[model samples]
Structure formats: structure tokens, C-alpha cells
Target: MAANDFYKTPSDAVTAVNSIYFLLNAGSNAVQTPYNTLFNTGMNFMGDDENPGPGATNPDVRSQSVLGHASTGLRVLQIWQQHYSGIKKANIAIEKIPGIDFGANTKLRERLIGEAKFLRALYYFNLVRLYGGVPLILKDLSTLEEAHSKPRRNTVQEVYAQIEKDLIEASTVLDPIAGGADAGRATAGAAKALLAKVYLTQRKWENAILKANEVITGPYGYNLVQNYAEVFLPIYKNGPEHIFSAQFKSVSQGQGNNQAPRSVLTGVPGIVGSYADQVVFYSVPDATKPGGVDKFFSVYKLYSKKDKRRDVTFVTKFKSPTNGNWYGRLNDPAIPGDSVPFFNKYWDPANVSNLAESGANVPIIRFSEVLLILAEAENELNGPTGIAYTNINKVRRRAGLDDLTEGLSQHQFRDSLYLERRLEFVFEYQRWFDLIRERDAAGNGILESSLHKVGKTNASAKHYLFPIPQQEIDLNPNLEQNPGWL
Candidate 1:
């Protein structure tokens, strides 16, 4: 059947859009996909909050951890390929689905197209952030000539303009609530929330606040989950707080959440796990240690004991099921000898037999982030107005923390909000983006400074945007590399 002939009915349109979603998280045959452990690990390693564990011996992975990855790096190439693959799938659906005849179900056709637009926007958003500017391929190319003719990278402003256009159109057509089996699909609120984030990234303060406010007050019914831990629980997937999340299920091969296995520590009896990554901790010089080794510092020490989010975010110790003995203490000060904390958000207790069978969904966007966006944008424009304080306090109150000081300058509030984002979203593939986008009072790039604070001195201004993959540039000579990469 011809490609155009296949989309003659609503079922055909649905199937096409479904493939895009599959590529977004779970590629065919258990392959690594965007938002999966392999991709998130690369992002996490680049941030200050995570480090490649001892078991992660991949040179590509280690290169990113030390900010030494080049344009030829495998991790960089994989990220570029997977996201564009998703974009291609999205383009086919967006172009073909509109021609399908839905008869009485016209809304279904529109909804499918909206989903495709939302996904395409998301792919471009990530691409622009990582590569500064990327090829803005919207329509499906019919021939190799068409493909090769338009390989030039668009301007960063042009890419963002397309992202905003897609999200705006998607916001109009998508349902406010994706309920029943459609729980993980993009909703109207999700589109607005993501748009708010895009605006925030561009430093468009008023626009960001407007989009965030639409999500907050719009009939989406999004709110912070009363229990901080319940937000990531598998049973509570697509709960009130989740605006959109990448769906995962453990019943089939290639469908489980791989983040769980990678984050879990190995050598724990009865648990087959690989500690491919762990939370970052500070270190101090110790003269008495052999080889003058530095003592370990626990990242969890930054969290207050009373903060309910601390226990839910990091695992300091766990009881071994095989021997019934606790391996480490809760909140042990890692002076020199203490277990390193692993991420707890994706750890699934039910999938102990095979950590790869964990079914927890990776959140793409949720309500709490929208609140933070509103707070950050409002403060940027209005300087910590009552509206900003109220939204920020909502998250703080949930974490069992006191409100912000009675009066704070815009700088103080901005610093506090950034810290809250680091703590609230650890290991969720957010820290790296925040590190790159955030600016200091002097308007200088902060990625190098932030990495320097965490003992990674290799980061420079060029580290803000990853190099465009060398393989890509080789394939299309017109695809120029980002500055400092060549």
C-alpha cells in the first residue's frame, strides 16, 4: 500500500501517532530510546548532582562525566539520532493524519495531529537546547534529494519559533484531561506548561508567567500530591500532579523503565542490579588516608533532616532481603566510610526479581514544575511579588519547609528557587538543563562555574551546548558544528 493510501481511516491515523510515542521512550526490540536510562545517564553525568558509578565503564559515558566528550562521542551521536528519529515519525503523522477521514469522529483526527505536533515540538525543544540550533524538518521528505537539499541548521530563534507554534496549535486541540487509557497522552495543560518552560528558557518573563498561569488556573485540575514520595510511585502513575509522562509497562520486553536497574546498587543479595550511576557528593582532602585519598562527602547532607523529600529522593541504606541485615544507616555522614546514596525515585520495590522490570514512568512535565516556572518568571518581572511567594511556598510547604524569609531581593529568591529545583527534581533529567540555562547576576554563563563548584573544572563556556555530532556533519557537510566543537 502506498504511504498516502494507508491513512484512509481513523484507525490508521491512530496507529501512526502511536509509533511516534513508542519511539519517544521505548524503541522497538528493547533498544535505547530518548528519556530512557541510557539518555538520562548522559544528561545526569553532565550535571553536578550525578556521577558515573564504578560499574559504568563505557568511555562515552565517562567522557561526558568529565566534560571531555567530543563531537564524535557515541552518547552524543545516540542522542542526536534518537530525537530526530522521533521527529521523523512525528512529521509523517502530522502530515498524513490530517488527510484521514474520521466521519463522525472529527475530534479524534484533530487530537491525533495535536499529539504529533506536541511531540515534534518536544523533540525540537531538546534538540535546540543541546545543539543550539538544528535542522527544522517539519514535513516528510519524499526523496533523497529533498532530504539532502535542506540539511542546513536553522537559527536558534527559528527553531524556538517553530516549537512555540506547534505547542500553541497543540494547546488548542488537545483535551484538557487525558483520562482512562489516554492518561499519559499530552493534555492541553501539558502544552501550556511546556510552553511556559520554553519561554522561561528564553528569558521571556511575562510570556512564561502567562502560559504557566494558564496551566495553573485552567481546568486541568493539576496540584501537588500531598505525599512527596507518592508522585513517583508506579501505582500512582499519571496521578493528579503528572501533566505528562513517558509511559512504561513491565509486562513486555523493552517496555520496562531502565533507570531503575542502572541506579540500583549491585552486590545486594537477591537483587540483580548494576550501579551504573550514583548521586554526586562532595569530597575533602584527608592527609591520613592511603595515597592521600580524599574523604567522601554525602550529597544528602545538603537536605535538612526534616525535609520529607530527602528520604524519598535518595537511598542511603537498604535492608538486604537475603540476610535480613541493613547495609547502611539512614543519613549517615559520609566522613570517610559510608555508603554512597543512590537515586530513590525510580527504584521499584516490586520488581526485585529483575530490576529491568520496573514500570515507573519518567515524568516529562508535572504540576510542581509549572508552579516553579510561575514563581521564577514572576520574580524576574515583578521581583518576588505575593504571587511568586505563594506558588513557591506551595512546593516548600509540601516538603515540610518554612516559607521564604519575609522579604528577599530578587537575587536571593532566584537562588532559592534554583536550589529548590535541584532538590525537587534530582535524577529526573532536569539538573543539566537548569545548569546550562541559568545565569548569574552579571549575565555570564554559569555552567562552567556550577561544574567548578562540584570539582569538574573541565567545563567552559563551550560546554553550554553539546557539540553537533561529527557523524551528522560527515553525512551532511552543510550541517556545521557548534562553535568550539570543530
Candidate 2:
């Protein structure tokens, strides 16, 4: 059916909304594209906090760790294509759903539009963050002529303005709660939380603080789960702590979610005994799982012994099923196996039978992040107040750590907040983006120094924004490349 036909009925509208999410989990679905893995790898593993696993040699995997991928590479190109494809799908829904009259269920029209707007904002958010100032395509193209003659790239400010507007509108129309099969769908809290991050990135502290407070204390009643590990368990996929996630259900390869491969470590020799049998390959699965190949840093090491979140975040060692021998001894290169602990946040034993496609939901945002945003915004707006300490300590106490020290200077508190977010959000694709986000008094990134400290020397000012994919510029001459990339 045509795009307009899909929005004429409420059932079609739901399907249209669900179609936007497919691009997020799109793997090798006959389109010959790979996106979810590439985006996650570039954003999460390409930084100082995570790197190639010991003995990893895949050029694509190593290139991210070393910051050497070209715009023409499949990794960069696919991310560009997928986001725009999703944007196109969202635009169609947004254009058609608004005018349709849903009879007695008029509220459904508003909710579907809100969902489309939220998703479109998310696509634009990813685009702007990775490749600063992408083309802002909001309306559905009626003809190939218009599609071919696209507009020039929008300014980063213009893009953020649209994102903020969409999210603000979405927040007003979306219901505060969604459950059952709709559990993973967007809500008012999701829109507000994402808008708060956008505000935070732009250094709009008061606006960020306001939106974050709404998510924290709004009608959603979101609160951190007492146990950190419970956050990722399949049973807790849409738990109170989860604000939004790209939903995944384990099934066949072509039928399964693509990101599943990015979380499993089946082929690593000693790490997973007889690696071949440990995972089943159906469609094209990447050679490595991004999280598995990620080596930990002091941010993970600094966790106090009393901190309960440590065990859930990573595994220091594991016993091989073949020889019953334990592997993963940290800092001891003399050992026979890989010592670096694998990220455990997405581990699922059930995936063993379902091939490498895990059922774990990739977290887009969680309540814990909301708490940290609140803390950081409060501190930035008004130096270390009781509210700031309480917000941050809520996360600390959950991890079994004591409350943050009182009377810290604004600079000290800022550093403290950064550290907490790093430790709490490891491997969820925030590190690299955090490093390059906002500039300081000297016009340098706030977290760029941290990247240098971990030997990401290639992460210079040019890398603050990734190059616009060459393929995109070739197709639309109006799209200009970022500076230093030309």
C-alpha cells in the first residue's frame, strides 16, 4: 500500500509507527546495509574508555579504536543511509497522520503524530551528533525531482531547534505511560529526557534542568531499580528504570534484530569455549561484538569494593566449559587467555540456543541517566546544592557507594558528575559523544582531555564531528562536508 494508505486506519498508523523502529534493528535484510552495529561501534568503542579486545585484528574493528575509518567505508555510509531512510518513514507518518480524523478515537491521531515526531527527532539527533549539521528533511517528498534537488545542510543550531520543537510537541501529546507490546514505545518522559540531553549538549542548563526534572518527577513515576543488573535482564526490558529502548526479541536470523550480534562473544577462543558451537549464525553477523572487544579502563577499575554495580557491568573472569579452566585474569599478560573482562550488561544465556542473536534490548535511555542529568544540570545552574548531591547520591547509593562529598567547588562537582556518568553509563554509546560535545572557556571540549589521557591521540579537533559520508555529498551536491574533512 502507498504511504498515505497506511495512515488512513488506526491499525495502519500503529504499523507505520512501528516501521520507524525497524531501521534501528535493521541488519542484513536484503538491502545490503549494516547500521546499528556501525553506529554503536563508532560512538561507544571508538573512544578511550573502550578499545579492541586483546588480539583483535578486524580492520573495521581496529579502525574505530584507532579513528581511521574513511567516509566511504561501509560503517560510515550505512549509518548515513539508515538514519535518512528512517527519517523518510517518519516524515511520511508525520505528514499523513495529522489530518486524518480518527472518529471517536481522535486521541489516537495525536499519539501517533507524537510518536512519529519523537522518532524523527531521534533520527535527527543521531545525525547531528555524529555528523554535525545534516540536511533537515522534514516533509515527505512528492516526486523524484524534489528528492534529487535537496537543500543544503542546515546549521547545527537550526537542526537542534527543530529537534527541540518536535520533542517539546511530542512531550505534550504522548501519553505518560505505555505497557504490554507497547511498552517499548515512546512516552512523554522519553521525549522530555531526550530534549533535556539536547539542552545539556547546547549548554542550556536551565532548560535541561527543567526537562530532566519532569522526567524524574513527572507522571511516569520513573525510579532507579534497586539492583543494577536488573536493568538489562530480558524480564526487565521495559522496567521502571528503562525510559526507552530499541526492542529486540530473539528469533531466526533474517527475522531477528541486528544489534544482537553486537552483544555476543561466541567466536573468541578461550573466552567462549569452542566458540563456533556457542553461537549460531544465520544472516550476516559481524565478526566481533562491539562490547566484547571493548577493554575496560580505570573508570571501571575505580569502583570501590563495596559498589554493587561493578559485577553487573563486567566480568573479570569466566570458566571455560571445555577445560573447566578459568580465563580473564586482569593485568597478567603471562596468562594463557584474554584477561580483559567482557561487558556483561547485554549477556543472555538464552542466546546460546537462538544463535548469536541476543534478546537484550539496547538501551537508548534509562532513568539512571535522567538522575545524573539532573545532578549535572543542578550543579551547573547553581553550584553544588542539596538537590544536586541528593540526585547524584541516589545513583551512588544504588551502587553501594556512599554519598558524594559535600562543599565541593563547581569545578570539582562538574568533574565528579562526569566521573559518575562515565562509570554508570559505560558501553551504552555515550563516551565519545560526551568528549566532543560542548566547548570550554578556552574553546576546547570539556572531555577532550580525558580522551587524550587514555591515548586517543587521533581524537583531535577534526574528529569532534565525523565527516559527512562521501556518498551523501555525491548524491546531493548541496550537502557540504565538515571542515578538515575536505
Candidate 3:
């Protein structure tokens, strides 16, 4: 039957073809979620508490604080396994392309290969950064025998080199912009951007800036959104300025919906009375969680007032459907307090789905982030100057703000750029990167006493990269562990 042929012929298996790429992106209920530092701003669970995400929702995957629970072990393993699975799928697609093919449409074939390579490189990049040098498994494992023996940790240099190779290959094969039904596919610009990041991590300053400039100036269909808010509008998903984003389309709640929805779903009209701390906040939180204890709304308002992205990225009481006036955090959780503020930024209230089922595709990588990267990388490479300031100001200009012509000293420039990144990209997983990048050649990233109030973290070599999972170390004698692990 025709249906049987579709399943048997690799060329006809379009669903299988797409599934190969989705493995890297499919959201899982992993433990030690970014909710602690990234998703959450109010909660103070860091160096002291080892366990991170004890599911405020699920009991099974909950670990007290990510201290040393076994389930957390599984969750961490899941992160590795799932991403590797995606990488495997990509490698398989690359290998099988020549043999069992996707018709004679040469362009489609090249695009598919480009996208697969992009995903493969990304998966490896994520792994290598987390575990230092991991085994570079490029070939598709067919037999169980090959699978068991082939998995070996590669050297850090080797892994970085592989990432570079794959990204370059993808760049050559991909189009600048995916169009029509192919918009979600990886593009040449995306490949180039990821390569820029890879270069930045390796401290190859000139190359990082050059590659970033290429994307900024090149014709891959990216330009800054006129309004900071427009950048994240779900109505115009994958807006003009987005270089690459995790695309989510809901066919009544299918793939792409993520924890992105929690900002609103979890903020439903209710008293934050868990602790008698009824800070019914109607605004975005700063260093302190606006609604939770040890929370402060003053910093949020003060910092955000001048930040252009403040209004667009948040649904402050000032922009709410009601009086549109700023309401600070409510101090009492018992009464659904008089002046309650909630974050409506990461949610579409129209979404009637359950808390975990929201479909606001998280913006993991975007043109705005690259702009900041170039600004910082250029500052590092060229020191404080008008040239680097131009890039930095472009970011600020969008947030309804002015350029930093005044803070021209090298130290001041560095401090200003890093703080701008922190304030602009709040809860977007950039804070950790900021701390990492602050390290000098000697590896010191100390927060001056002034900034310690946010989360004072002193960086050492042990933290440059996370420790290799002990399980993997025990199972594979070849895998050496990172420093500072038991």
C-alpha cells in the first residue's frame, strides 16, 4: 500500500525526518531547572542549598535543593541523554542522506542537511560547555554493540573544533532566511551566529566580533525591532529581529509550549500567602522577588524606569488592563491584597491550558543577544571607545534609553555593559554568562560589594565548567572528571 511505502522509504518519511531534529528541542520535565536563578528571581537557593528544583508541582522529580538526590541525578542524565539523542539523530540524517534520499530537490536536501548540522553542533556545544570535553560521537549508531563502545568523552579542544566544523558546514549549506513553510528551519545566519558564540566562549575576540558583525550587517533577514516589546510579541512570532528562536505553534497544545507560560499561569489572581509575606506585587521583581519575602520592588521600578525594554518585556501595573498605575508588591499574602502585581510578560492569558502547557516559545537566541555579545566582545578586545559604545547604545536605544558616552573608562565601560546586559536580558539565562565572562585571564569574577546584593558569587576554575556527572565518570574509566568534584 502507499502508506506502507511511505513508512518503508526513508525518502517519504517526512515525519521521521522532522523528528530527528526535534529531539534537541523537545521540552522535558528535567530537574534542577533554571527556575531557581533564571526563571525565578525571588527565591534565594544557591551555594548553600545543593538541590535546586523540588518541583513546586511534581513530587517524584522533586529534589530538596538539588543537593545530592538520586532523581536529580536522573534529571541531569536526562538532559545529557536527550540532547545526545538529538545529536545522534542529526548525525544519522547526515549519513543516510546520500543513500536513502529525499527526492532530487537539491535545495531541499541541502537545507535539511544544513539544519541537521546546525542542531548537531548546538547539542554538542551545550554538552561540551556543561561537561568540558565530551566524547564526540559523529557517526550514527546502528547496532547495540556500536552504541555501547562508541560513546567516549572527547577532549575540550576536539569538541570545540567539531562544533566549529559543523557550524561552518551548516553556514555554507543554509539559506540566510527560511521562508514560506520553512521559516523555522535553521539558516546560514543562525549557523554563523552560533559560531560567533562558540568563538566568544573560546576567547577568540576578533573572530567573535567579525562573525557577529557579519550577521548584523549581512542579509539573513535580521534587524532590530523598532520597539523592544515587538521583539517578543507572540502575535508576530519570530519577529523581524529574531535570528533564531525556539518556534512553538499550538494545534490545541502540541509541541513548542514550554515553561514560558508559567509567568502568567502561575500568576493567576491569588494571594501570595505561603508566607505571611503578602507582597501582592503588580510589577516585575528586581533583586528581591516582588511577591516573596526578601523581595524588593523599589529596585525594579528604579532600574526599569529608564530601561527601554521595561514596559515591553513586562506587564507592570502601569501597563495592566486596569488603572495602568504602578502598584508595588503587596506585603500580605492572606488577602488577595489591594495592590497585587503580576508578570504578564511570558504568558498569553488567553491560553486556557494547564500551568505547564503554555505555548510561548522561549527566545533562547535572538539578534538582541548577539548585539550585546558584540558590544561586550568589542569592549574586551578594543577597550572602552565610541565604536563599541555604538553597539551598546543600539541596544539601549531600543529600550527607550540613551547611550553611555559618559562612562568611558575601561573599568566603567565593562561595568556598564555587563549591567546593561543583566538588566535588559533578565531571566533569560544571561546572568550566569555575565558572571562567567567577567573572569579575567587570571580567572577572577568577584562582585564588588555594591553588586553582591543581587547574588554574590565568586568564580573559580571549578565553576568555569560544571563537573562531569559522577555516574558517567564511574562507568567510563576514560572519562576524567573536572576539578572540585568528589
Residue-level lDDT for 109 in candidate 1: 89
Q: How big is the RMSD of model 1?
A: 2.7
Q: Candidate 2 on 331-436: residue-level lDDT in tens?
A: 4353233344556666655654343356677788889888888888888889899989999999999999989998899878887888788778776767667777
Top candidate by lDDT: 1
**Cα distance off (Å), candidate 2, residue 147:** 1.5
Clashing pairs in 1: none
Most TM-score-accurate candidate:
1
Candidate 3 lDDT (Cα, whole model)?
0.59
Q: Rank the candidates by TM-score, best first.
A: 1, 2, 3
TM-score of each: 0.95, 0.88, 0.78
For 198-288, candidate 1 gives per-residue lDDT tens digits of 9999999999999999999999999999999889989888999999888888768668888787777677787766778876766656576
Instruction: Choose 1 or 2, whichever is better by TM-score.
Output: 1
lDDT of each: 0.85, 0.73, 0.59
Q: Residue 451 CA error for candidate 3 (Å)?
A: 9.9
